[model samples]
Target chain A: MWRDALLVGGKDLRIEARSRVALAQIAPFGMIVLVLFAFALGPDQSPLVHAAPGLFWVAVLFSTVLAVQRSVAVEAGDATRDGLRLAGLDPAGIFLGKAAAVGAQLLVLQAVLAAGVLLLFGARVVHPWLLLGTCLAGAVGLAASGTLYGALSAGVRLRETLLPFLLLPVVAPVLLAGTRLWQSSLAGGAPDAGASWMRLLLVFDAVYVALGVVVFGPLTEAA
Target chain B: MAPAAPVPAPALFLRGAVALSGRFPLLAGVDLEVAPGEVVLVEGPNGAGKTSLLRVCAGLVPLASGTVRVLGGDPADVRTGVRRRIGLLGHASHLYDDLTVAENLRFAVRAAGAPVDGIGPACERVGLVGRLLRTPAGKLSAGQRRRVALAALVARRPELWLLDEPHAGLDASARGVLGVLVAEAAAAGSTVVVASHEPELVAPLATRAVTVAGGRVVADRATPRPVSTAGTGVADVA
Candidate 1:
């Protein structure tokens, strides 16, 4: 299954290796979100630190959605979708490959935005590595949900318009939980809280990955 | 020369398969048996469930109420390894518009875990040599794009090719090229299932043709079809 997932995901990454769609959407959107975050709350150290958890997570969530969707949209538009299915490979492989591609793209975007945030607002991550972990965790969530939503949207009329509605609702549990978890972790606010939220995120990751694999073929093939 | 090998019994067995979405039934009791190495051309009018049947056979679409078996295992089973041998060609061939032709081919091979170095021979098999290696997929003509797609099968050398309109856009010579490659694939013991409106292309490679209408199999004949003995529009369907 992992091999299959890698195969599908590799296809996406291999194509995006030369394609600029990832760079064009992911970097700019991430940077812009960071800019918006700076404007929304700034000029105070205590407030910034207090707000960092929510602010950072918010930045990660929205930007990742756009990046992930754009990645899947490429697959949706061309023969890539059918080819993957026809290759007689696994759908989970497709999800994983796509999720990983979008994940790597998110990592790059997050790094750039993190640098931009430091430069502009002097807002530095409490533990830079933890923030990276947050980005990674958040990425899995986005990819898991976005891949399925993207599949669903591929069938829906006007996918661009429908994706947000379909995604935001399904994506809330992870976004909210991830946001809260990252905030608490960053501030060292709740180290021993209910592991259920993060646990939920993990379970969401596993189930959604499987769901993406199972549903993607039909979801994409549907009208 | 010896006679062609007889197709083994159907590996994919669907018994009265019915797939429905709420009130709309995509298909009703579709009983299909696809033998190994059999060239079954699935035909239908638009929305007649040609794609639906292919999806079911490939184990992508779910049955509303019926049993579908791929090589004697449940199709919806995530662990069903039957997909490894089945190849489908549809509108979404997954070709990268921005990547070079060679890059796209290599990507498909690597992603599918098929041999990678076969790109050269695969390209040669599809007659894609010299003319369009460095060209981005965005710039390739429609016929060239189909060749790029056909090159996909060459990489895997799949045992089955489930195609939806394989010859949508091609000149007379181009059609002949497609027919030859298809016959070569089938003659090599591959099962080819194509759904198309082109009479010239189907008549040549088809061992049996099934015309589908209203989401059900209307005709299933095993008689030999007319080979492409002449130019386009000359091959007759029986």
Candidate 2:
């Protein structure tokens, strides 16, 4: 399973490297999302600073959808999904590999957005560990759920619209926990207050990742 | 009563198999048995369920009802055991657009647990060498992409080959290479099932022709071609 996971993970990352869709398109889209939010909240730095944590997570959330969609699109045509099914790779491995790829991309995006929050919103991180932990846990939760929902809607014609609808609601917990945890990690915030939200984010990540590995085969086959 | 004489299990078997797509019956009922090393050609007009037949055999589509088996096991089984031994070249080339032709073939071979070293020779056999090998699949012409798929199939060397419209999108020379490949696979004891509308092209390679209509096998018969003519003519074309 691990071997197949590495095979599939490497394949996805290689495709990303060649195409640059994630780096070129999706990453820019994420930055634009952050820029747009800052504009909506206006030139007042105080409001922007208070809203930085939420806006940062909101950007990550939206990017997760696009990343998952891109991941699905890689196998969308040429019966590539059917080919993978026939290739005999373990479905669990395929799920983990895909989620890992998305996680990797999300991690990079988070770093960029983290800097964006620091620079644009003038927000300061009081507890670097808590901020990092929140982003990592939130990214995994979002990636796993996004991958699951992406596969569910993969066969549908309305997947473009359906994915966000199916995915956003399921990943709301990550967004909520992420926002709260980020808030607690910011300057003039209580670091100890984030423990519950951090645990919540971890639990969310574990549940979906486990569920994705168990059900991805049947889900994709049905799709 | 004396024990019944034992029979070798066919490489592929379908008994009263029925498959559906929504309200439409893609395969009303298909019963087919293909022994090892027999090249069976599935000939039919458009929308006659030929593609569905091949998909069903590959376990891409589940049978709504009836027993179906491939390679001595259920193709629908979740285990990769049966799927690993089967190779399918569907209408879609199944090549990742971003990856080069060589990368696609290598991935397929590795995924199928075949030796990756066969990729170089397989590419050469299909005439996919030099710039074409490094070209991304999305950049290749239809014929070139078909050659890539054929090369990937060759690299894997599956026990059962399910090809749909194998002759489409290929130049005469490339088609000739495909013909030789099919013949060689059969010669190597692999069971081949080809679904095609072009009967004349597949005539020399197939040992039998099975006509499909409305998702059922309407006709099945032998087409015994002289080995010397098929081999020599295809060789000359190649």
Candidate 3:
């Protein structure tokens, strides 16, 4: 099972690398998103920096979705799907492999976004460690929920449109907690406020991941 | 008592297998008994429940009512091993276009956890070894794609093969290859069921002919016309 996940995960990563969807767009998209936020924030240093966490969370959230959705879509072809069903690899393994691939892609994208945010938008990470932890937790929840949605939308006619609709609502809570954590991290690592949100994000990730283990199988096997 | 009929291994049995679509029973009271080492052909025209019937037998669609058994176990309760014993080749050929033939086979084998000696032999058998060695499936012609898809049978070694139009895109020679492989699989103690509208082709190969219309098995009699008795090929009715 681990072997299958590694193989499929490696295959997905290779596909993304070949496509360059990850490395190419992350910086530009993240920059565009942040620049838009900057424009909205009206170039005021205090306001821009103050809203930096909010803007950062929004960008990361949308980009995380993009990466995760693509990871699942790439593996959802008819032959591949039927083969996977017959292959005897646990469905949970496939989901995990996909989630892991998506998570990695999101991480790589976030790294690029981090540099772009710092350089172009003049955003500073006052709490590097805290910020990274919050983002990782958020990414896990996003990936976990995204895996279930990916499998659900696999063979549907209008899958791309359907994915976000199905996932966004369920992902709302995680994003909310993530946003709160980002706000705290932005407020110069405020000890009291940020800690609780960080804890919430962790719990969100853990719960969603365990839930994914139970639900992803039926979704994958569905038609 | 007469010695049990080589009883290869019951590939599929439906004790009143019923499938309902909306309010209608697409297939009801379908008692289909297929033994091991039999090439059972199902003949039906358009909208005659051929696809639905095959889907039910393949354990794809749930039975609205009735019981279905495959390989001596209830299909619904059967484990992955039982599901693995039933290889299904549908209308699309279900071959991954992006992956090469060998890679596709490897993926299928890995996913299925099926143990086979060598894919090299299967590739050679499907006559895809030369052009298909590293050919991306998307680049292959329809016939080549069909051949590659059909090659799954060799790798799966399934006890029951539910092939829906396995001969559509193939040329005469390719059809011959397919027929031979089907016969060979059945000869090796596998039960084969296929839904086809063309009778001439299947007539020379089928042991029993089962016809369905309006969602029920209307006729399921051993070809009083046997393929062997008629001195053609295997017992099959297309």
Candidate 4:
């Protein structure tokens, strides 16, 4: 299973590297969203700083949709999905491999978004460890849940419009927990407050990851 | 006393298999049995479910009812590992556009847990050696892409070969290469089932011919020879 996961994950990452779609298109789109957030909230840096966590996650959320879309789109052409199915790898491994690839891409996106928040919003990081943990946890949750929904919507027409609707609602808990964790981490509040949200993110990640691994096979086969 | 000889299981066995696409039945009822080293040709018109049958055998499509056993196990049951020994070339080439021809074949072999050493020879066999192997699949012509897909299949050397429209995009030479490859695979004990609109290209090579219409098999016949040296003539199946 681990072998299949690494092979699949490596294949996806290599495709992304060659295509540069994530780097050129999705990442830049994320930066643009960041710039737009500042404009919409007015030129005042105070409002931007106050809304940094929400804006950052909002950007991540939207960009994640793009990333997931591209990831799934690569399989759309040809019978690539069927190819993966016929490879006979464990379905859980396929899920993990895809989620890992998406997680890796989102991490890069989040890193740039983080810098955007710090530089553009003038948001200072009070606890770097806490902030990094929240980002990693949130990214995992997003990748897991996003990949599950992506597979669900893969065979459907109008999936482009359908995916965000399916993914955004299901991912609300992650958004809520991620936002609160970011707020607590940046504020340097009591470690317990951050810990609670961190626990929430961890739970979210575990639940979706498990769900993805269990359901991906049947879902993909059904399609 | 002489020891009892063992009987080999059929490479593919389907009994009253029914499958659907949404509300419509794609395979209302399909019963087929293909022996080891047999080459079966599936011919049908558009919307005739030829592709779906191959997909079903490959375990890419679910059967609504009835039993489908490929390589001695239910293909529907993924844990059986039936899929690992099956190579399917469907309507799409299944190659990543971003990956080079060589990379695509390598990926397929690796994914199927086959030896990576087969890559070089597979490419050569498919006439994709040297610079062509390095060319991205997205840049290749339709015929070239088909060759690459065939190379991947050759490298994997699956026990069961399920090819849907195998001759669709190939030129005469490539089509001949395809025929040779299919013949070689079956000669080596692999069972092959090909669904083609132009059945004549594969007709002489087929051990059996099955025709599907309205989601059911309407005809099944045995051919005179296991390997045909006849010229390509269009089979009037439609």
Candidate 5:
């Protein structure tokens, strides 16, 4: 299973390296979303600083949707999904590999957005460890849940609209917990609540990742 | 107690296979049996369930009610086990567009747990060499992409070959190469099932012909001459 995961993960990353869809398109789209949040908050730096954590999490959520879509689109071409099914790779390994790839892309996107929030919104991290932990936990939950929903919506003509509908609601816990944890990590924020929200994020990640590994094979069969 | 004498099961066995797509029946009560070392051709018009027949045999489609055993085990029950020994070249080439020809074949071979050393020879056999091997699949023409798919199959060397329209996009020379490859696979004891409209192209390599129409097997017959002799004029068998 580990060997198959490595092979599949390596294959997906290589495809991303050549295609540059995440680098050229999705990442920039994430930055644009951050800028748009600033526009909505107006010229007041105080409001932007106050809302930085929530806005950043929202932007990452949207980027997770796009990243998951891109991951599914890799298999949507021709009979590539069928080919993968026939390739005899372990389905759990495929799930983990895909989630890892999406998570990796999400981490990069979050870093860019983090820089944007720090520079543009004037928000400073009081506890950098808390901020990093929140981002890591949030990205894992988002990637795993997003991949499961992506597989559900795959092969559907309306997946473009269907994915966000199916995914956004399922990931609300990540968004809420992520926003809360990010809030506690920022300056002049509540530090005591950080540990609980981090726990919530971890729980969400474990549930979805486990569900995905067990169900992905049967889901692909139906898809 | 001594183990029972090993008996070779039919490479493929299907009886009363019924597959449905939505409300419509894609395969209605089709029964097929293919022995080891036999090359079978499936011929029919559009929407006649030829593809569905092959899909069922490959275990891509779940039989609504039937018994199917490919390599002596029901593919649905032992999916990865059955699939590992079956090479299916469907209508689509199934190549990753971003990956070059060599990368695609190498990935496929490795995924199938086959030796990657055969990739070089397989690519050469399919006429993908030098610059062609380095070119991304998305940049290759339709015929070239098909050749890449064939190369992956050759490198894997599966025990059972299920090909749907195997000659669709190939040029005359490539078509001849495919015919010879099919014959060679059969000679080496691999059972092959091909679905094609141009039966004449596959006629020389196919030892038997099966016709599908309205989701059922309407005709099954053996070619008059041996497949190894470059036989001709068996297209009308169906």
Candidate 6:
């Protein structure tokens, strides 16, 4: 299963490398969201800095939808899905491979967004470790859940509109926990203060990842 | 009395297979049985459930009723090893548009757990050698993409071959190559089922032809004599 997962994950990453969709389109789109948030909140630096964590996560969330959409779109054609099915890899492996690919892409997107937030919003990271951990856990939760919902609505005509509605609500906890964790980390609150939020993110990641792996096979075959 | 020879199990079997699209029944009742090494051609009119039949065999479509067994196991069930031994070439090439032909073949080979060394020979067999292997699938013409898809099929060397409209976009040479590959696969004891509107193109390679209409088999006959492919154009019966 791990072997197949790596094989599929490698294929996705290689495709992204050549397509440059994430780098050229999705990453830029994320940066623009940051700029838009800055504009919406005015030029006052202090308030923007205070709002940086929330705004950054919002951008990540929106960009995550785009990234997840593209990730699933690669397998949009029936032939690709059929090929994946016929290849005989474990369905859980396929789910993990896709989630891992999405997580990897989101990590890069988040890094860029983090840099943008720091430079544009003048936010400081008081405890870099906690912030990093939060971002990692947050990305996993988002990607796992995003992949599950993506497969759920994969072949539907309204997938583009439906994905956001289905995904946004389920992922609300990730956003909330991620925002609080970032706030605590950036504001020099005690490191343990954000531990509970981190735990929530971890739990979210575990449940969604487990659910995705179990249900993905049946869903792909049925869809 | 001498002991009787054992009967070979069918490569694909569907009994009372029923499938629906929304409220409409696509496969009202589909019962098909293909013995090992048999090359069966499926023909039908548009919306006659030909594609659905193949999808059911490939485990892509869920059965609304009845049972389907491919290689002695239910396709609806998650059987990785069973699926690994089957190759399906649908209307879409299934190649990653962003990846080069070589990369696409490599991915397919790896995914099927086939030997990586088979890639070179498979590409050669499909006539996708040289610079064609380096070109991304998106840049290739439709014919080239079909050849790339066929190359992956050759590399995998699956036990069962399910091809849908395998000759739709190919030129004369590619079509001939496809026919030869189908024949060769069956000769090697692999079961081959092809669903094509251009029946003549596949008729020469098929051992039997089954016609599907109104979500059921309308005709089944042995093709003892090969049909000429000359002047055969796409007939949208199905």
- Which candidate should be chosen as best, given TM-score against the real structure? 2
lDDT of 3: 0.72
Runs of candidate 2 exceeding 4 Å displacement:
B1-6, B226-232
What is the TM-score of each candidate's chain B when compared with the real chain B? 0.83, 0.94, 0.86, 0.93, 0.92, 0.92
Worst 10 residues of 5 chain A by lDDT: A187-196
Question: lDDT per residue, candidate 1, A1-223, as tens digits?
Answer: 6887665566667667767665776677766776676667766666665665565556766776677677766766674665565455666666667777777777777677666655665554455554566567667877778877877776555878787777777777776776666565555565446266677777777878778777775565563
Q: What tens digits encode model 1's per-residue C-alpha lDDT throughout B1-238?
A: 9999986667668788888776787887787787766667777788888878777777667788888886667655545556666666665556778778887887777655678877788788666888598888888887888788778667777666778787776666556666766766777778777888764458656777887877677788874653333343334211
Runs with alpha carbons beyond 4 Å of true place in candidate 6: B226-238
lDDT of 5 by residue, B1-238 (tens): 9999986788999899999998899999999889898999999999999998888877778899988889887666434478778899988988999999999999999988889999998888778999999999999999999999999999999999999999889887777778778888998999999999998878778889999999988999997656662633222221
Interface RMSD of each: 3.0, 0.9, 3.0, 0.8, 1.3, 1.6
lDDT of 4 at B66: 92
List lDDT for all candidates, in order: 0.69, 0.88, 0.72, 0.87, 0.87, 0.87
Question: Any runs in candidate 4 off by more than 4 Å, and if so which?
Answer: B1-4, B228-238
DockQ of each: 0.42, 0.78, 0.44, 0.80, 0.69, 0.68
Cα lDDT for residue B114, model 4? 93
The CA lDDT at B190 in model 3 is: 81
Model 6: clashing residue pairs? B44-B238, B45-B237, B45-B238, B46-B238
True contacts kept of each: 0.52, 0.64, 0.34, 0.84, 0.59, 0.80
Residue-level lDDT tens digits of model 3 in B130-215: 76668877688888878877777678788788888877887776676677777677667788888887767666668899998877
lDDT-wise, the better of 1 and 3 is: 3
How large is the interface RMSD of candidate 6?
A: 1.6
Candidate 6 lDDT over residue span A28-60, tens digit each: 999999999899999999989899999989999
Q: Report, to 2 decimal places, the DockQ of model 2.
A: 0.78
Off by over 4 Å in 3: A1-4, A24-31, A153-158, A183-187, A190-193, A221-223, B1-9, B21-25, B76-80, B224-238
- Writing each residue's lDDT as its tens digit, candidate 4 over B1-238 gives 9989987899999899999888899898898899999999998888988888888898888898998999998777779999989998877888999999878988889999899898888887778878998889999999898888888899899999999898888887777778878877888899999998887788888999999997888999998766754453222110
Clashing residue pairs for model 2: none
